[model samples]
Target: MFFRIINRIQPCTSQQRLLSRSPALQNSLLQQFFDDEENFGKQELRAKKRPGRSWTNEELRLKSSEDLHKLWYVCLKERNMLLTMEKAHKATARHFPNPERLDRVKGTLKNIEEVVHERNDAYYQLETGDSASAPKRTVTSFMGFTYEKRAEEHYSPPGEGQKGYEVPYLDDDAYLMQKLWNEKELCKERDRKDNLARRQLANDEMKHYKRGGRRTFDRLEDLKVYQ
Candidate 1:
Protein backbone atom coordinates (compact mmCIF):
# COMPACT_ATOMS: atom_id res chain seq x y z
CA MET A 1 0.00 0.00 0.00
CA PHE A 2 2.85 2.44 0.84
CA PHE A 3 4.76 1.60 -2.40
CA ARG A 4 1.63 2.23 -4.61
CA ILE A 5 1.01 5.67 -3.05
CA ILE A 6 4.67 6.62 -3.60
CA ASN A 7 4.49 5.59 -7.33
CA ARG A 8 1.30 7.67 -7.90
CA ILE A 9 2.82 10.73 -6.18
CA GLN A 10 6.04 10.31 -8.28
CA PRO A 11 4.07 10.39 -11.58
CA CYS A 12 2.15 13.53 -10.54
CA THR A 13 5.42 15.25 -9.54
CA SER A 14 7.05 14.35 -12.86
CA GLN A 15 4.06 15.68 -14.81
CA GLN A 16 4.22 19.01 -12.94
CA ARG A 17 7.94 19.27 -13.64
CA LEU A 18 7.42 18.65 -17.36
CA LEU A 19 4.66 21.27 -17.57
CA SER A 20 6.83 23.88 -15.82
CA ARG A 21 9.79 23.09 -18.09
CA SER A 22 7.88 23.90 -21.34
CA PRO A 23 6.17 27.29 -21.89
CA ALA A 24 3.72 25.74 -24.41
CA LEU A 25 2.81 22.96 -21.99
CA GLN A 26 2.41 25.44 -19.15
CA ASN A 27 0.23 27.67 -21.39
CA SER A 28 -1.88 24.69 -22.49
CA LEU A 29 -2.27 23.61 -18.89
CA LEU A 30 -3.26 27.09 -17.71
CA GLN A 31 -5.22 28.16 -20.91
CA GLN A 32 -3.43 31.56 -20.81
CA PHE A 33 -1.43 31.64 -24.09
CA PHE A 34 -2.82 34.92 -25.42
CA ASP A 35 -2.89 36.54 -22.06
CA ASP A 36 0.88 37.32 -22.37
CA GLU A 37 1.71 41.09 -22.27
CA GLU A 38 4.44 40.85 -25.02
CA ASN A 39 2.09 39.23 -27.57
CA PHE A 40 -0.54 41.90 -26.88
CA GLY A 41 2.07 44.64 -27.51
CA LYS A 42 3.11 43.00 -30.80
CA GLN A 43 -0.52 42.81 -31.96
CA GLU A 44 -0.95 46.53 -31.25
CA LEU A 45 2.19 47.34 -33.24
CA ARG A 46 1.00 45.33 -36.25
CA ALA A 47 -2.41 47.01 -36.19
CA LYS A 48 -0.74 50.43 -36.34
CA LYS A 49 1.02 49.74 -39.66
CA ARG A 50 -0.45 51.59 -42.73
CA PRO A 51 -1.04 49.67 -45.96
CA GLY A 52 0.84 50.47 -49.23
CA ARG A 53 -0.35 53.07 -51.76
CA SER A 54 -1.73 52.94 -55.36
CA TRP A 55 -0.27 50.90 -58.23
CA THR A 56 1.37 52.57 -61.23
CA ASN A 57 0.66 51.88 -64.92
CA GLU A 58 4.18 50.58 -65.61
CA GLU A 59 3.90 48.15 -62.74
CA LEU A 60 0.56 46.91 -64.03
CA ARG A 61 1.84 46.59 -67.62
CA LEU A 62 4.87 44.60 -66.53
CA LYS A 63 2.69 42.07 -64.68
CA SER A 64 1.72 38.83 -66.49
CA SER A 65 -1.92 37.92 -67.13
CA GLU A 66 -1.83 35.59 -64.14
CA ASP A 67 -0.29 38.31 -62.00
CA LEU A 68 -2.85 40.84 -63.24
CA HIS A 69 -5.66 38.47 -62.36
CA LYS A 70 -4.21 37.92 -58.94
CA LEU A 71 -3.70 41.68 -58.59
CA TRP A 72 -7.37 42.23 -59.39
CA TYR A 73 -8.37 39.89 -56.56
CA VAL A 74 -5.86 41.52 -54.24
CA CYS A 75 -7.18 44.99 -55.13
CA LEU A 76 -10.74 43.85 -54.51
CA LYS A 77 -9.73 42.34 -51.18
CA GLU A 78 -7.83 45.52 -50.26
CA ARG A 79 -10.87 47.70 -51.03
CA ASN A 80 -13.08 45.48 -48.86
CA MET A 81 -10.46 45.45 -46.15
CA LEU A 82 -10.20 49.23 -46.21
CA LEU A 83 -13.95 49.59 -46.09
CA THR A 84 -14.18 47.28 -43.11
CA MET A 85 -11.34 49.09 -41.42
CA GLU A 86 -13.00 52.45 -42.11
CA LYS A 87 -16.27 51.23 -40.65
CA ALA A 88 -14.51 49.93 -37.56
CA HIS A 89 -12.57 53.17 -37.21
CA LYS A 90 -15.76 55.20 -37.47
CA ALA A 91 -17.38 53.01 -34.85
CA THR A 92 -14.45 53.54 -32.56
CA ALA A 93 -14.37 57.31 -33.21
CA ARG A 94 -10.84 57.12 -34.65
CA HIS A 95 -9.46 58.73 -37.81
CA PHE A 96 -8.71 56.32 -40.67
CA PRO A 97 -5.30 56.84 -42.30
CA ASN A 98 -4.98 57.17 -46.10
CA PRO A 99 -8.69 57.41 -46.92
CA GLU A 100 -7.81 58.10 -50.57
CA ARG A 101 -6.73 54.44 -50.92
CA LEU A 102 -10.35 53.61 -51.83
CA ASP A 103 -10.29 56.16 -54.66
CA ARG A 104 -6.93 54.80 -55.84
CA VAL A 105 -8.43 51.31 -56.09
CA LYS A 106 -11.30 52.70 -58.15
CA GLY A 107 -8.85 54.50 -60.45
CA THR A 108 -6.84 51.29 -60.85
CA LEU A 109 -10.01 49.42 -61.82
CA LYS A 110 -10.78 52.10 -64.44
CA ASN A 111 -7.26 51.79 -65.88
CA ILE A 112 -7.68 48.01 -66.08
CA GLU A 113 -10.94 48.47 -67.94
CA GLU A 114 -9.24 50.88 -70.36
CA VAL A 115 -6.46 48.37 -71.03
CA VAL A 116 -9.01 45.61 -71.58
CA HIS A 117 -10.95 47.83 -73.97
CA GLU A 118 -7.79 48.55 -75.99
CA ARG A 119 -7.06 44.84 -76.33
CA ASN A 120 -10.68 44.07 -77.18
CA ASP A 121 -10.74 46.77 -79.83
CA ALA A 122 -7.59 45.38 -81.46
CA TYR A 123 -8.97 41.83 -81.42
CA TYR A 124 -12.43 42.87 -82.67
CA GLN A 125 -11.04 44.91 -85.57
CA LEU A 126 -8.95 41.92 -86.68
CA GLU A 127 -11.74 39.29 -86.46
CA THR A 128 -15.09 41.10 -86.93
CA GLY A 129 -16.59 42.74 -90.05
CA ASP A 130 -17.12 46.04 -88.20
CA SER A 131 -14.42 48.58 -87.38
CA ALA A 132 -13.64 49.07 -83.69
CA SER A 133 -13.59 52.84 -84.18
CA ALA A 134 -16.62 54.94 -83.21
CA PRO A 135 -19.28 55.35 -85.93
CA LYS A 136 -19.91 58.92 -87.07
CA ARG A 137 -22.70 60.68 -89.01
CA THR A 138 -22.32 63.99 -90.88
CA VAL A 139 -24.65 66.65 -89.46
CA THR A 140 -25.19 70.26 -90.61
CA SER A 141 -25.18 72.70 -87.70
CA PHE A 142 -27.31 75.87 -87.32
CA MET A 143 -24.28 77.87 -88.54
CA GLY A 144 -24.23 75.75 -91.76
CA PHE A 145 -20.95 74.06 -90.75
CA THR A 146 -20.87 70.29 -91.30
CA TYR A 147 -19.98 68.33 -88.16
CA GLU A 148 -19.72 64.64 -87.42
CA LYS A 149 -22.04 63.24 -84.80
CA ARG A 150 -21.25 60.02 -82.97
CA ALA A 151 -23.59 57.18 -83.95
CA GLU A 152 -24.95 54.98 -81.18
CA GLU A 153 -27.09 51.84 -81.39
CA HIS A 154 -30.80 52.64 -81.12
CA TYR A 155 -34.08 50.78 -81.68
CA SER A 156 -36.40 53.82 -81.86
CA PRO A 157 -38.51 54.56 -84.95
CA PRO A 158 -37.24 57.20 -87.39
CA GLY A 159 -38.93 60.55 -86.88
CA GLU A 160 -40.76 62.53 -89.69
CA GLY A 161 -39.47 61.84 -93.25
CA GLN A 162 -38.21 58.25 -93.62
CA LYS A 163 -35.73 59.03 -96.44
CA GLY A 164 -33.41 60.96 -94.15
CA TYR A 165 -34.13 62.52 -90.76
CA GLU A 166 -34.87 66.20 -91.31
CA VAL A 167 -32.51 68.33 -89.31
CA PRO A 168 -34.68 70.90 -87.49
CA TYR A 169 -34.61 73.88 -89.91
CA LEU A 170 -32.69 76.84 -88.51
CA ASP A 171 -33.49 78.59 -91.82
CA ASP A 172 -37.16 78.95 -90.85
CA ASP A 173 -38.51 82.46 -91.77
CA ALA A 174 -38.64 83.69 -88.15
CA TYR A 175 -35.18 82.36 -87.28
CA LEU A 176 -33.64 83.69 -90.54
CA MET A 177 -35.24 87.08 -90.02
CA GLN A 178 -33.84 87.32 -86.49
CA LYS A 179 -30.36 86.25 -87.67
CA LEU A 180 -30.33 88.68 -90.64
CA TRP A 181 -31.52 91.56 -88.49
CA ASN A 182 -28.77 90.90 -85.93
CA GLU A 183 -26.13 90.66 -88.68
CA LYS A 184 -27.30 93.88 -90.45
CA GLU A 185 -27.32 95.76 -87.14
CA LEU A 186 -23.82 94.56 -86.32
CA CYS A 187 -22.50 95.55 -89.80
CA LYS A 188 -24.09 99.01 -89.59
CA GLU A 189 -22.61 99.63 -86.13
CA ARG A 190 -19.16 98.50 -87.33
CA ASP A 191 -19.31 100.77 -90.43
CA ARG A 192 -20.39 103.76 -88.35
CA LYS A 193 -17.46 103.34 -85.93
CA ASP A 194 -15.01 102.81 -88.84
CA ASN A 195 -16.15 106.02 -90.65
CA LEU A 196 -15.86 108.03 -87.45
CA ALA A 197 -12.30 106.74 -86.89
CA ARG A 198 -11.34 107.56 -90.55
CA ARG A 199 -12.78 111.07 -90.30
CA GLN A 200 -10.80 111.78 -87.09
CA LEU A 201 -7.60 110.48 -88.73
CA ALA A 202 -8.12 112.69 -91.82
CA ASN A 203 -8.76 115.77 -89.69
CA ASP A 204 -5.58 115.14 -87.67
CA GLU A 205 -3.53 114.82 -90.90
CA MET A 206 -4.98 118.13 -92.23
CA LYS A 207 -4.01 119.88 -88.99
CA HIS A 208 -0.48 118.52 -89.25
CA TYR A 209 -0.16 119.78 -92.89
CA LYS A 210 -1.43 123.28 -91.90
CA ARG A 211 1.08 123.46 -89.04
CA GLY A 212 3.92 122.56 -91.47
CA GLY A 213 2.84 125.27 -93.94
CA ARG A 214 2.71 127.90 -91.13
CA ARG A 215 6.25 126.92 -90.02
CA THR A 216 7.49 127.56 -93.62
CA PHE A 217 5.74 131.01 -94.00
CA ASP A 218 9.21 132.76 -93.83
CA ARG A 219 10.13 130.78 -96.95
CA LEU A 220 6.85 131.82 -98.72
CA GLU A 221 8.74 134.65 -100.66
CA ASP A 222 11.34 132.05 -101.85
CA LEU A 223 8.40 129.89 -102.91
CA LYS A 224 6.84 132.77 -104.92
CA VAL A 225 10.21 133.67 -106.53
CA TYR A 226 10.69 130.08 -107.65
CA GLN A 227 7.11 130.09 -109.06
Candidate 2:
Protein backbone atom coordinates (compact mmCIF):
# COMPACT_ATOMS: atom_id res chain seq x y z
CA MET A 1 0.00 0.00 0.00
CA PHE A 2 2.83 2.41 0.92
CA PHE A 3 4.70 1.61 -2.29
CA ARG A 4 1.53 1.95 -4.33
CA ILE A 5 1.04 5.55 -3.13
CA ILE A 6 4.71 6.32 -3.69
CA ASN A 7 4.70 4.90 -7.22
CA ARG A 8 1.51 6.64 -8.37
CA ILE A 9 1.97 9.98 -6.55
CA GLN A 10 4.13 12.34 -8.71
CA PRO A 11 2.79 15.65 -7.28
CA CYS A 12 3.54 18.37 -9.91
CA THR A 13 4.26 15.74 -12.56
CA SER A 14 0.73 14.36 -12.16
CA GLN A 15 -0.74 17.88 -12.11
CA GLN A 16 1.12 18.75 -15.30
CA ARG A 17 -0.21 15.62 -16.94
CA LEU A 18 -3.73 16.56 -15.89
CA LEU A 19 -3.23 20.15 -17.10
CA SER A 20 -2.09 18.99 -20.49
CA ARG A 21 -5.06 16.63 -20.86
CA SER A 22 -7.79 18.74 -19.24
CA PRO A 23 -7.20 21.92 -17.22
CA ALA A 24 -10.59 21.47 -15.46
CA LEU A 25 -9.46 18.14 -14.00
CA GLN A 26 -6.77 19.91 -11.96
CA ASN A 27 -9.46 21.28 -9.58
CA SER A 28 -10.60 17.76 -8.63
CA LEU A 29 -10.85 16.48 -5.02
CA LEU A 30 -8.19 13.85 -5.71
CA GLN A 31 -5.78 16.59 -6.80
CA GLN A 32 -6.68 18.62 -3.71
CA PHE A 33 -6.00 15.68 -1.37
CA PHE A 34 -2.86 14.78 -3.33
CA ASP A 35 -1.52 18.31 -3.01
CA ASP A 36 1.23 19.17 -5.50
CA GLU A 37 3.70 21.17 -3.38
CA GLU A 38 4.80 18.77 -0.63
CA ASN A 39 6.54 15.41 -1.08
CA PHE A 40 3.64 13.49 -2.61
CA GLY A 41 6.38 11.19 -3.91
CA LYS A 42 8.28 8.34 -2.22
CA GLN A 43 10.57 10.79 -0.42
CA GLU A 44 7.85 11.32 2.23
CA LEU A 45 8.00 7.59 3.09
CA ARG A 46 11.46 8.21 4.59
CA ALA A 47 11.91 10.22 7.82
CA LYS A 48 12.76 13.89 7.55
CA LYS A 49 16.10 15.01 9.10
CA ARG A 50 14.34 18.02 10.66
CA PRO A 51 10.75 19.01 10.01
CA GLY A 52 9.28 22.51 10.49
CA ARG A 53 8.41 23.42 14.07
CA SER A 54 4.83 23.66 15.33
CA TRP A 55 2.95 26.99 15.09
CA THR A 56 3.24 29.09 18.21
CA ASN A 57 0.17 30.56 19.93
CA GLU A 58 1.59 34.08 19.62
CA GLU A 59 2.20 33.66 15.89
CA LEU A 60 -1.31 32.26 15.38
CA ARG A 61 -2.86 35.13 17.38
CA LEU A 62 -1.26 37.75 15.13
CA LYS A 63 -2.69 36.32 11.90
CA SER A 64 -5.91 37.76 10.40
CA SER A 65 -9.03 35.57 10.34
CA GLU A 66 -8.72 34.76 6.63
CA ASP A 67 -5.03 33.98 6.92
CA LEU A 68 -5.62 31.86 10.01
CA HIS A 69 -8.42 30.01 8.21
CA LYS A 70 -6.10 29.18 5.33
CA LEU A 71 -3.33 28.10 7.72
CA TRP A 72 -5.81 25.87 9.57
CA TYR A 73 -6.75 24.07 6.32
CA VAL A 74 -3.06 23.70 5.42
CA CYS A 75 -2.37 22.15 8.82
CA LEU A 76 -5.46 19.97 8.43
CA LYS A 77 -4.28 18.74 5.04
CA GLU A 78 -0.82 17.99 6.42
CA ARG A 79 -2.38 16.02 9.28
CA ASN A 80 -4.49 14.01 6.83
CA MET A 81 -1.39 13.32 4.73
CA LEU A 82 0.52 12.13 7.81
CA LEU A 83 -2.38 9.91 8.94
CA THR A 84 -2.69 8.38 5.45
CA MET A 85 1.03 7.66 5.42
CA GLU A 86 0.75 6.15 8.88
CA LYS A 87 -2.16 3.92 7.84
CA ALA A 88 -0.29 2.71 4.78
CA HIS A 89 2.79 1.91 6.85
CA LYS A 90 0.73 0.10 9.51
CA ALA A 91 -1.15 -1.92 6.87
CA THR A 92 2.20 -3.14 5.55
CA ALA A 93 3.43 -3.80 9.17
CA ARG A 94 6.08 -1.06 8.90
CA HIS A 95 6.90 1.94 11.07
CA PHE A 96 5.52 5.34 10.00
CA PRO A 97 8.09 8.03 9.14
CA ASN A 98 8.37 11.20 11.25
CA PRO A 99 5.72 10.33 13.91
CA GLU A 100 6.42 13.68 15.59
CA ARG A 101 4.86 15.42 12.59
CA LEU A 102 1.48 14.12 13.80
CA ASP A 103 1.97 15.70 17.24
CA ARG A 104 3.20 18.99 15.73
CA VAL A 105 0.26 19.25 13.35
CA LYS A 106 -2.24 18.28 16.11
CA GLY A 107 -0.80 20.96 18.41
CA THR A 108 -1.01 23.57 15.65
CA LEU A 109 -4.65 22.68 14.98
CA LYS A 110 -5.45 22.91 18.74
CA ASN A 111 -3.75 26.32 18.98
CA ILE A 112 -5.67 27.51 15.93
CA GLU A 113 -9.01 26.36 17.41
CA GLU A 114 -8.20 28.01 20.77
CA VAL A 115 -7.32 31.32 19.11
CA VAL A 116 -10.48 31.20 17.01
CA HIS A 117 -12.56 30.43 20.13
CA GLU A 118 -11.05 33.37 22.00
CA ARG A 119 -11.82 35.69 19.10
CA ASN A 120 -15.38 34.38 18.83
CA ASP A 121 -15.96 34.75 22.57
CA ALA A 122 -14.70 38.34 22.54
CA TYR A 123 -16.91 39.22 19.62
CA TYR A 124 -19.95 37.50 21.19
CA GLN A 125 -19.41 39.27 24.55
CA LEU A 126 -19.07 42.64 22.81
CA GLU A 127 -22.26 42.20 20.81
CA THR A 128 -24.57 40.21 23.12
CA GLY A 129 -23.11 40.80 26.63
CA ASP A 130 -23.05 37.04 27.28
CA SER A 131 -20.49 34.24 27.12
CA ALA A 132 -20.09 32.49 23.77
CA SER A 133 -19.13 29.08 25.17
CA ALA A 134 -21.57 26.18 25.14
CA PRO A 135 -23.92 26.02 28.12
CA LYS A 136 -22.97 23.22 30.48
CA ARG A 137 -24.47 21.94 33.73
CA THR A 138 -23.25 19.83 36.60
CA VAL A 139 -25.34 16.65 36.63
CA THR A 140 -24.96 13.27 38.29
CA SER A 141 -23.91 10.30 36.15
CA PHE A 142 -25.34 6.77 36.36
CA MET A 143 -22.38 5.71 38.52
CA GLY A 144 -23.38 8.36 41.10
CA PHE A 145 -20.69 10.87 40.16
CA THR A 146 -21.09 14.49 39.04
CA TYR A 147 -20.44 15.12 35.35
CA GLU A 148 -20.51 18.29 33.27
CA LYS A 149 -23.26 17.86 30.67
CA ARG A 150 -23.57 20.34 27.81
CA ALA A 151 -27.21 21.40 27.46
CA GLU A 152 -28.85 20.93 24.09
CA GLU A 153 -31.75 22.93 22.62
CA HIS A 154 -35.08 21.40 23.66
CA TYR A 155 -38.78 22.25 23.45
CA SER A 156 -38.97 22.44 27.23
CA PRO A 157 -36.78 22.06 30.29
CA PRO A 158 -35.51 18.50 30.75
CA GLY A 159 -37.74 16.18 32.91
CA GLU A 160 -40.72 18.57 32.83
CA GLY A 161 -42.77 18.25 29.61
CA GLN A 162 -40.57 15.45 28.17
CA LYS A 163 -38.86 12.52 29.87
CA GLY A 164 -35.63 14.44 29.78
CA TYR A 165 -32.60 12.23 30.28
CA GLU A 166 -31.39 12.28 33.86
CA VAL A 167 -28.77 10.32 35.70
CA PRO A 168 -30.60 7.05 36.34
CA TYR A 169 -31.51 5.93 39.86
CA LEU A 170 -29.97 2.68 41.05
CA ASP A 171 -32.31 -0.20 40.19
CA ASP A 172 -32.71 -3.46 42.15
CA ASP A 173 -29.82 -5.03 40.23
CA ALA A 174 -27.61 -1.99 40.85
CA TYR A 175 -28.49 -2.03 44.55
CA LEU A 176 -27.60 -5.73 44.73
CA MET A 177 -24.28 -5.04 42.99
CA GLN A 178 -23.52 -2.23 45.39
CA LYS A 179 -24.36 -4.45 48.37
CA LEU A 180 -22.03 -7.18 47.04
CA TRP A 181 -19.26 -4.67 46.51
CA ASN A 182 -19.65 -3.31 50.04
CA GLU A 183 -19.62 -6.83 51.49
CA LYS A 184 -16.46 -7.65 49.55
CA GLU A 185 -14.75 -4.49 50.83
CA LEU A 186 -15.81 -5.25 54.40
CA CYS A 187 -14.45 -8.81 54.13
CA LYS A 188 -11.14 -7.42 52.79
CA GLU A 189 -10.92 -5.01 55.73
CA ARG A 190 -11.64 -7.84 58.19
CA ASP A 191 -8.97 -10.02 56.60
CA ARG A 192 -6.44 -7.18 56.69
CA LYS A 193 -7.18 -6.48 60.35
CA ASP A 194 -6.85 -10.19 61.26
CA ASN A 195 -3.53 -10.37 59.36
CA LEU A 196 -2.21 -7.29 61.19
CA ALA A 197 -3.20 -8.74 64.59
CA ARG A 198 -1.46 -12.05 63.76
CA ARG A 199 1.67 -10.16 62.68
CA GLN A 200 1.69 -8.22 65.97
CA LEU A 201 1.34 -11.47 67.95
CA ALA A 202 4.20 -13.02 65.99
CA ASN A 203 6.38 -9.98 66.64
CA ASP A 204 5.62 -10.16 70.36
CA GLU A 205 6.66 -13.83 70.43
CA MET A 206 9.90 -12.93 68.66
CA LYS A 207 10.55 -10.25 71.29
CA HIS A 208 9.90 -12.85 74.04
CA TYR A 209 12.44 -15.19 72.38
CA LYS A 210 14.99 -12.33 72.10
CA ARG A 211 14.59 -11.46 75.82
CA GLY A 212 14.79 -15.12 76.98
CA GLY A 213 17.67 -17.11 75.54
CA ARG A 214 17.04 -19.53 72.63
CA ARG A 215 17.14 -22.54 75.03
CA THR A 216 14.13 -21.24 77.13
CA PHE A 217 11.87 -20.63 74.05
CA ASP A 218 9.57 -23.31 72.50
CA ARG A 219 10.57 -22.45 68.90
CA LEU A 220 8.24 -24.96 67.13
CA GLU A 221 5.12 -23.88 69.10
CA ASP A 222 5.95 -20.18 68.54
CA LEU A 223 6.37 -20.81 64.81
CA LYS A 224 3.03 -22.68 64.68
CA VAL A 225 1.22 -19.76 66.42
CA TYR A 226 2.71 -17.28 63.95
CA GLN A 227 1.93 -19.46 60.93
- The parts of candidate 1 lying over 4 Å away from their true place are 1-48, 91-93, 129-168, 171-227
Among all candidates shown, the one with the greatest lDDT: 2
Q: Give lDDT: candidate 2, residue 151.
A: 69
Summarize candidate 2's per-residue lDDT along 1-227 as a digit string, tens digits: 33454333333576435333443234566444443334433344334444688998899999999999999999998888678756655655555555787899999999999999999999999999866888787665444444678867778665754432455576666567767878899999988876765666555667777653233445677554333
RMSD of each: 22.5, 10.4
lDDT of each: 0.55, 0.66
Candidate 1: 10-residue stretch with minimal lDDT: 34-43
TM per candidate comes to: 0.40, 0.54
Supply the TM-score for candidate 1: 0.40
Question: For candidate 2, which ten residues in a row score worst on lDDT?
Answer: 34-43
- Evaluated at residue 134, the lDDT of candidate 2 is 85
lDDT tens digits by residue: candidate 1, 126-194: 899566667777765555444677766668966674323225565675477668878999999988876
